[model samples]
Target: MSWIRSWKRLGLFALLGLVLSWAISCGSGTPPSTTGQQPSGKQEVEFWTMQLQPQFTDYFNQLIATFEKENPTLKVRWVDVPWADMERKILTAVSAKTAPDVVNLNPNFASQLAERNAWLNLDEKVTPEVRQLYLPNIWQANTLDGKSFGLPWYLTTRIAIYNTDLLKQAGVSKPPATYAELAQAAKQIKAKTGKYAFFVTFVPEDSGEVLESFVQMGVQLVNAEGKAAFNTPQGKAAFQYWVDLYKNGLLPKEALTEGHRYAIDLYQRGDTAILASGAEFLNTIATNAPTIAKVSASAPQITGETGKKNVAVMDLVIPKDTDVPDAALKFALFVTNDANQLSFAKAANVLPSTVKALQDSYFQTAPVNATPVEKARIVSAKQMQSAEVLIPAMKNMKQLQKSIYDNLQAAMLGQKTVDQAIADAAQEWDSRQ
Candidate 1:
């Protein structure tokens, strides 16, 4: 279970080579510091963030300068890597023992490295007080085998963005609050307005969404022993729900193959009634479809038997072999503290992971001149109260997601029964163990 072994098995070796070439041709592109102060006996620590340069160059440069000033014995060199190159670059670096002291990563990639023990267990490095600063579920997302490996940084959660005018036209006064209601509204909206209610894409890119829906419906997914438990009656019912949606024309014909961008396009063009999306997309709507933005209203994303919603989080992790582990953890804490996180959030229009940052009146109170984008942020912040990672992080997560998605596609396209699909997916997951 070496870091390189699982990644190589997943066909990432060629990508790793490319990352090495790029790293050699162009060094990490470390930003120049404004201050010329050099500290004596300073341990040079590399800190990497995924594609956050140029836009936040000034902000990070200042932060790095301040951090260096404060920690006279530690020097942090900031590296901004492209998002597409992160996984390969990170694997290559860690394997070669040239990994950064602190690196920014999403939960899945961080979990993959954590599973192989490539990251330091932060539960030992950070105090309970520091851990308590973040939302419990978000903090829990970075834990594996009862040990925490990363600190929650920033997050985004899906909210149900729907055309209020369309709901009104269909005689529905409110957006759907639950999965059943979402499906019912879809049926009514289609029957009354003749526009599709929502697009249910089952392509590889959207498998996580499908998994989230199933979990929302009370599917256990993985059992207590970590084997697939989604073959149960509840799982079948969840699968059947989508099959029924497709069979009855509640979903678009391209649902089997399309991706989120296509779904967004449909919603923007008023071809769909509802679009489950992150708050950032509200700006896209306003820019691309002014008319639709005028009619768009958002609600906390729909839930099911359980009321939890899905969230995607970015976090900071310390490499297990870092020479300056203490300095790295301290610098990571400095960057993610309430003030810094809030500053970054305001700049990026993303949500902060720190509880105090989230509780700041800025998030609690909506802007006076609220546009759809502003409204989305206010609503999304509220939605964060119950948000958690939808697809539980696990080793071999990609395989598990694909297994469930492929079977779901077969069931949706009428190639297999719901029961058969669930059984086959469960079997595949079990075989992986």
Candidate 2:
């Protein structure tokens, strides 16, 4: 959830890629027989990858070469865009009728474009065989208002990573499995060891995790008419859980304003005992605090009543106007195929969205000489069986999140009562509708 801000910053750019067919026409005409040459008048399909340059240039180049060889009549011009400039570049290209045929983007950004009818619906273009390749929940990430607009790419699921040494110091033999157990452990750890038991993050920018915690507790966020529905008993209990932790000094005071990075930094420096985060973060622990890495262990992500997990996914989408829709989709499928996905996952230490790729031994088997990082990968991949995007997609999702967190902050700071906070948040959400 903390990572969402980066993508949302680019979301406004979705409006940039509008219909350009009226301004200029696609290149289409003659035929060529050369192995790598497009027919003399064929339009080159543009492919854009986000911030994958410098490190992944070679990998992408090799894949592009192979693809061109197989489809000699089609030419794909690959472009690497910086993360900060992706929205601008894509939007500008679209406005000028120079948008890429295929582009790599996140679900949230794709959702924005889909809402504007600026993308091609894969359900109408791709075959059933191709549709069956991805994990069902992940494939749904690209669907906005019942239309599939993107293909699943790489993803990561968060899990509980704890300091075994710190737990041992507090006489905690195993990590807590439930919220109640976690609170009790925090109390015991603070009383015995004087170290913070948990970093209960409350930063407004990353408050979605707290919202997700409530969802895990069975709090429906919105009613059928899109009105706020979380001002209920379950919501009160969820908010009170954190309120109790903060007031009793069981949680880090910095948590009142900190984000995941701060919590991770505390764990790396041996100031905290637990961290609920993505498996990829283990690599940072390995690099920044080798000492903490030695005593670190991973477990399936902690959840509430349902025992499900949350995931962050990346996807590839096609703009509405493209000279080679079929050829573009063919290349998108090729890039996300099992073999290619597996190769990329291995190289990047990420999880693949394709079921076959996930079933591969690389994700299924634990290494004999496993380190904390390896342990995290195995645990995370296993948890993916029950994982899904934590927050449901909505046209006003960002606005809803801000409304909830603002009210939550007021309550946490004693500016309002829990009931009043929920009421206020619900009112704000309703007004937005």
Candidate 3:
């Protein structure tokens, strides 16, 4: 579900409309009209989601049908938006007061609108008993400034996918479980097999894995006051760690500009020994690179000494100005309830944010005849017990990424010392705050 953040589906016909729609959508954005109501007097609420069309269309249509059957007076209009266009579409839609009643978005983008009070404050809307339905940490992700703006939906956590052949070539019996072990294996794999141990982009705007790594390494991103906190001794060490990795040629050169896709390419091409990504990728590798898939095995994500892991959450947010706030919350809760979440998690190959849904036997235990993908699912689901959104959702999150990454790159290229890079990145963030 979180992959939609980086996934772009086909379209330029839509791209042309993007610029125009962006402007109009932001112009006092219009909320869905009441005009769509049928003669039966059922109130209609619109739901918007990132690119999940075609593949999940049938699933959702049935879900909506089922919901409507239960709530006879409420009708839902499902809008499936392309992934790349979400930001512009939402911005335009929200500003015009025409935003959907309930929308699916990640905290990274949703936080921006939340700061403007564009989304309803769920703390007041949902009862305390209702709040107890979700995993505490997952629910915590939707809160900003002590107010909840959304309810957690689907989740994703990465697991280590390693090539056994490559490990054998490097004389390593097991894939590394910690960053320290990963660093050592990187060198051994490089020397023995002439392959990188893994691929993680250094590109400022790409995957947030590297940034999450810093936190896993015990570097606080921002302090209690919400100012930059990554300039401490721990932060300097984290910066230097990446610098050394790049300078020593352990990371691929393309990492400087490439994104997670490139990491997948390298892993599939057998140029990297491991791929840290969603468990669903095991099925992908099995199809794309059967040879590699045959020898691949799943392990826990490479963590720092702290053993922290990162989780990606897709949330359900209701616009503050929506005409059907109560209806929206009810539908959202229905969509995310344990039964619905379990069904979607199974259909979508993602983890569920609902506590009971996650405790289902499907997630808790792999069958005796489980395939690699099945076992990986358990590994991913298990991480939910500890994984969380490492980067705190905030306004201008991309700016924070850019600052730290640009500085870190400079240090790697010998343009700045590690200390200077960390200091500069911290100052830039504080200035913005």
Top lDDT hit: 3
Question: Which is the winner by TM-score between candidate 1 and candidate 2?
Answer: 1
lDDT, each prediction: 0.78, 0.75, 0.82
Best by TM-score: 3
Off by over 4 Å in 3: 2-39
Q: Which model is ahead, 2 or 3, in terms of lDDT? A: 3
Residue-wise lDDT of candidate 2 within 1-433, one digit each (tens)? 1234422221111111100011111322111112222558555777777666556678888998898898877777776665656776666666666677888887876687788787888999988888998999889878877899999987766678899999999999899877878889999899988998767566666536777777777788998788998989998888788777877888877876776557778899998898877666666678789898888888887778877677777788888777677888889999999999999887667789999999998788888987777778888789879888767767788888788777877777789888998899999999988
For residues 248-322, write the lDDT of model 3, one tens digit per residue. Answer: 999998889888778878989899999987777777788899998998989988899778888878889999988
1-433 per-residue lDDT for model 1 (tens digits): 0011211111111122211122332655333322122355678778888666556789888999998898777788877776557888888888777788889887788898888899999978888988999999999988888999999987777788999989999988899999999889988999999998887567754436777888889998897688999888888899899889988888888887876557778999999989877666677688799999899988888889898787777789999988888888898999999999999888777789999999987788887887777888888888788888877678887788788888988988889988888899999999989
User: What would the TM-scores of all predictions be?
Assistant: 0.90, 0.89, 0.93
Candidate rank order under lDDT: 3, 1, 2
List of clashing residue pairs for candidate 2: none
Task: Count clashing residue pairs per candidate.
Answer: 0, 0, 14
